[model samples]
Target: MKLLEPPVSDYSTVFWDATREERLLLPYSGDRPFWYPRAVAPAHLDGDGEVDWRPAAGTGEVYAVTVVHRPGPGRAAEDGPYAVALVELAEGVRMLTNVVGCPPEDVVVGMPVRVCWHELSDGRKLPMFTPA
Candidate 1:
């Protein structure tokens, strides 16, 4: 089965580019960092809509996790038993990513993880996490 590609767009070019270099860049408005890069910062921020990109520490802990046994459309069932997790980064941001490089059943909440990359067929790297 073909792997899914990331949702890259004008507002997210920086993020996609960083992954290619093995870097994790998060978008910031003043001191507040947010995910899913967009044209403007979080609505609560009073600063101008402009944003800045910052290098992430690339370390986090599994805030939550689940093992997927069934694949969605276009995906293969043999890819079952993969771990999907909400990783709470040291920077205070939570990211939805897959926990790999280890057995799916072994992933647990509060387990430490570090950034890893999966190269895509289109020459872009997708960021995932592995036990630190």
Candidate 2:
């Protein structure tokens, strides 16, 4: 799939940059995880909306999954059948990414997974999930 990066001008740049290094970075503030990689603090969005990038454990469970038998674009189209999943990270946040390194039929909800990377055409590494 295409690895889309937020522009440096965007607040989510930290998330994209970290992934480029093969790391999973999450937006966190206070003591909880502010998921979906938004640059917002857990509480007090108006005041201390400032966020910090923290490393995620990279271990998670598949919350949901869908196998694409035919993709219209991106590597999924070239590669054919692949699994897209919502992975619930150990940090208590869920991210939508692809599940690789196995046949798509093998992906299941509640399946254990770990972080992996797929180098995109743009030379950026995209985080993917795989059997742990």
The lDDT leader among the candidates is: 1
Please, what is the whole-model Cα lDDT of each candidate in the order they appear?
Answer: 0.87, 0.77
Residue 35 of model 1, lDDT score: 76
- Assess the local accuracy of residue 109 in candidate 2 as a C-alpha lDDT between 0 and 100: 96
lDDT per residue for candidate 1 within 25-107, as digits (tens), equals: 99998988887677898787776878999999999999999987886544578777688899999999899988999999999
| Residue 124 in candidate 1, Cα distance off native in Å | 1.0
- Which parts of model 2 have CA positions greater than 4 angstroms off? 1-9, 42-47, 72-76
What's the TM for model 1?
0.92
Model 2, 1-132: lDDT tens digits are: 443442444786666667778988777775667676664565643446777777889999999999977673444366677788999999878898889998899999999999998776555677888999
Candidate 1 residues lying further than 4 Å off, grouped into runs, are none
Count: clashes, candidate 1: 0
Checking candidate 1 for backbone clashes, the offending pairs are none
